[model samples]
Target: MIVRIMGEGQVTLDDTSVIELNTLDDELLATIQADDEEGFRRTLGALLDGVRRMGTPLPDDTLEPSELILPASDATLDEVKQMLSDDGLIPG
Candidate 1:
């Protein structure tokens, strides 16, 4: 799930979860809201890119959804569990 925040006050999740800012999201939200457009874009791009890289490997336990994220639609608490199931790049 790729989460992106734009300079025009928009939040896009998985290319569908698009919404205007109603309130803050997290520490990330604070950063996005406070920084200049270019700076925000660069930082958010880096963070989002890092998360996208996490799904490079297929999980060993394919039957268990909990075991891997597999490019899912939403952010669940099982994220780390999912990443851990990957054959490459153990979750930190």
Candidate 2:
């Protein structure tokens, strides 16, 4: 799956990576629901950082549609909440 990080670039994740990200997404959603700003920021950073570390970067010239779009590292909780769906950012 290809995930686009706003202000960053697209990353291609394998199935195992997706599953792992899903776990982080679940934790992120929980933090959001609980209105834990610190937790949200920490988890969001970890999740985005994990994607950056684990996924392969897609070339700038590549035009493949992204399966998911994540907020930037500086995104506020409200901004991320707006982007969330029933499945969160990364669906399992």
Candidate 3:
């Protein structure tokens, strides 16, 4: 799957990486529901970092559509909250 980090370019992630991302997404949802800004920040940073570490960076010239769009590392809880869907950012 192709994941896009807002303000960053796209990265290609395999199925295993997608599963990992889904787990992080769940944690993020929990933090949002709990209204824990610190947890949200930490989890969001981890999620973005995981993507950066596990995903293969796509070339800028690539035009493929992204399957998921994630918030930036510095994204505020409110900003990320607005981006969440019923299935979260990355659907299982």
Candidate 4:
């Protein structure tokens, strides 16, 4: 799966990484629901860090469509809330 971090380029992640991301996605959703700013920031940072660690960065020239689009690192809680869906940013 190709994941895109808004304001950043895309990264190619495998199934295992996707699964891990899904777990983090759940945490993110929970943080949002609980209105926990610290948790949200921590989970969001973890999610992004996981992607960077477990996935391969796509070349700038690559144009493949992304399967998931995550908020930018500096995104506000309200902005992240706006980005959430029933399945969250990364579907389980």
Identify the candidate with maximal lDDT: 4
- Write one digit per residue (lDDT tens) for candidate 4, span 1-92: 99999899999999988887888989988888899999999999999999999989999988788889888999988888776744466553
lDDT of 2 by residue, 1-92 (tens): 89999889999999999889888988988998898999999999999999999999999888788898888999988877776744466442
Worst 10 residues of 1 by lDDT: 16-25
Rank list by lDDT: 4, 2, 3, 1
Off by over 4 Å in 3: 85-92
Off by over 4 Å in 4: 85-92
The superposed Cα distance between candidate 1 and the true structure at residue 23, in angstroms, equals 19
What's the lDDT for residue 51 in model 1? 42
> Residue 26 in model 3: shift from native, Å?
0.4
Instruction: For candidate 4, give the lDDT of residue 51.
Output: 93
Write down the lDDT of every candidate, Cα atoms only.
Answer: 0.32, 0.86, 0.84, 0.87
Total clashes for model 4 = 0
lDDT of 3 by residue, 1-92 (tens): 99999889999999998887888888987898899999988988999999999999999888788888888888888877666644366443
Off by over 4 Å in 2: 85-92
lDDT of 1 by residue, 1-92 (tens): 32321111112233222121112123234443454445444444554454444323233333222321222323232442344355422212
**Candidate whose TM-score is highest:** 4
